[model samples]
Target: MPHTDTPPSGHATDLALLLTLSTLWGASYTFIRIGVETIPPLTFIAARTLIAATLLLLWMRSRNVRMPRDRRVWMRFGVQALLNSVVPFTLIAWAERSVGASLATILNSTSPVMVFVATAFITRHEPVSLRKLIGVIAGFVGTCLVIGPSALDGLGGQLVPQLAIVAATACYAGAAIYGRSFKGLHPAAPATGSLLVGALVLTPASLLVDHPWALQPSVRSLMALVALAAFSTALAFAIYFRLIQTLGAIGTTAQAYLRVPIGVAIGVVFLGESLPSSAWIGLASVVVGVAAMSMPGSAIQVRRV
Candidate 1:
């Protein structure tokens, strides 16, 4: 899956895995929509993280992966939990409640642009270039298009939700930058560690704020929650980290451009939602922008080892 100048056959297989990852992840929004109907948002998120954390812990134990004994590394894991899991997980769930899955995933595609912008400020050594800036502008325009004209129906009413999605993207960007600290840790160790922290932080909040014990979720919703936990959270991370290792970050993020279509497909097929023509246009713009930002040699000098 590593990116190569000569273009190996693994490129094709990596593309296939990326497509599959997008499909699985895109379907998550629908599952969230269905599951949230029966479970409170906080409860749903907390439960999913807990289940995923438990599974990851068990897997790590089976693999003989030792937890980081250093408090600094554990603190880094906590930061990762916040930026990667807690904040974005809550924001996207909240946004999905209002914007629906297709649009939400489109919004999520803005991560690359967000990362570019963040890198401009966060890493002084790697400033944003004019081309990257154009991609950022195009990504925002595409986001606006996806939201459609009716987005302004109320006086600044749509601002919060739109901003929430943006905040989610910011969280992802921050996670990507912050996760550089974990480059030394085994992938599963950090992955499991952060999920544990996420569960610890979120569970008490879910209990105190939502009181999920008092309200019962339907069986269908429970199943959806389990699927989201097992497939979307745990399995997705497994595949994602593997892809990141095998293909590198740029190559893995190339898959972001593909997520929009798969998101739309799952939204239409399962949720019976249709997108506006403008949304499709927006998606096209996003694809172009992401492709620009992710082009080999545009930023990183990735090499297959």
Candidate 2:
């Protein structure tokens, strides 16, 4: 199904939307931090996908958009769920148990770089240029700085959790590349379908491992879970679709870097978390790199929906 939105008012409105989307996504790390404190990662992510998927279905229904019934498209959605939601969502939830939201913000902000690497080397689905190459190098150096000696100190400890966040970022990159397969889909379709698939994949494992029925989650955790699913996952997808149409793919990607500072600020203000000086420097590098990668005419715009 398809429909048209009234033309956006102007750049200011677009900017507001950009900020809103960033704020919503930025707050997600903190939500995960709070929720996972009481809810086990598996059960928490399962519930998240369940809530988000249901909301996305309602969103689609409101838009008069019907999900694809093709079995093959659904199978593709299953693979997308594995990459976009199931694995990465679980990894981030598990990682946040030890890693702070600020670090996760910086570490997870490198998806464009990851997407570029995958596209350039493996897929070659898009052209590469000097500017984007520079962006890649800058992001790589920043990622190494964020992950290497100063932060790691050793192989174990926070290092494994940090690496897990990076791995989750990689999974998102893979999802972006594969998402192009749904080129003709209503934006709501892939989002709703993938989330539904994610819920299906995670629910059984969560039941077996966590036995959520026996868990006693606090009010703060439960509220955080609701916020995480409603605002961060579901509402963010709605905003993403709006931006994709109004701002074009490249313009919407500005959120990639913008959310870094926003996420860090949210962590500090709400969660009382802080990052080391080296991580700060790495964060700056990542912001610059992502901005460079997100510039006009990059040919690597990755639409999350």
Candidate 3:
């Protein structure tokens, strides 16, 4: 059914949701770091997606909304699941094995940059304004600063995992763009369907490679896994789809800028993590860049019903 109501032209509500989403997603890096210590990456992601899918399914049932029956929609869900959940979740988990939660979050902040690039170069879905272009470049430079000079020196050895994080962000960028197709669908529908597909795709791989049934995970790890699935995945996607419907891809992805600071703070407070002076400078740069990118522009107008 086509939506009858107009989407809000004002961004205040979307901004609040964006902040909440960033906080949840920011904390996810910490949970991922904790969970991966006991569970293999593939197994961990499989469980997370499955748990999220179950929760979303239950929510849908409560709302009396049926899953989409169209095969084409399901196929799109499959692709979205691969890009948005399975691939990025696995890569981030794998990267966190070597990368600190703070650093991983910082690296993951590149998603908006990738989104800008994709939108300008490939999708052409939106025009590239001078401010947005500058903002993207500034954000990338800030990201490099966040990694600091010492980390750069060791970049050669950690190149694969670092690149893996970058690749994961790229997948997120792609997923954000692809997800626009679901704008007309109920928000919960695409999130639920994508998670279901992700779970199905990874279950076999996790079972074959990790034999999760035979493994013993700690209670702490179990708690982290639950939080990762419930708060970060299920609830996060619900808000994510809503933001996408109202904010468009670039605006929604702008949350990546906020995630780094929030993630770093979570790491520092809860995990007792610390960063160098350069990282602080880089963090400020990213915040400024994101603000610049998020400034009201002609290209950012959302379509109201």
**Residue 297 displacement in candidate 3 (angstroms):** 3.3
lDDT-wise, the better of 1 and 3 is: 3
Winner by lDDT:
3
Estimate the lDDT of model 1: 0.69
Tens digits of per-residue lDDT for model 1, 123-195: 5324345655565666556655655645445424556876887788778766665655565456666677888
Which RMSD does model 3 reach against the true structure? Answer: 4.0
Candidate 3 has a TM-score of 0.88
Better of 1 and 2 by TM-score: 2
Look at candidate 1 and give me any clashing residue pairs: none
Q: Name the TM-score of candidate 1.
A: 0.78
Residue 8 Cα positional deviation in candidate 2, in Å, after optimal superposition: 10
* lDDT for position 79 in model 1: 94
Clash count per candidate: 0, 0, 0
Provide the global lDDT of candidate 3 against the true structure. Answer: 0.82
Stretches of candidate 1 exceeding 4 Å from the true structure: 1-17, 124-156, 242-256, 268-295, 298-305
TM-score of each: 0.78, 0.79, 0.88
Candidate 3: misplaced stretches above 4 Å? Answer: 1-9, 143-153, 271-275, 278-284, 299-305
Question: Cα RMSDs of all predictions?
Answer: 5.7, 5.0, 4.0
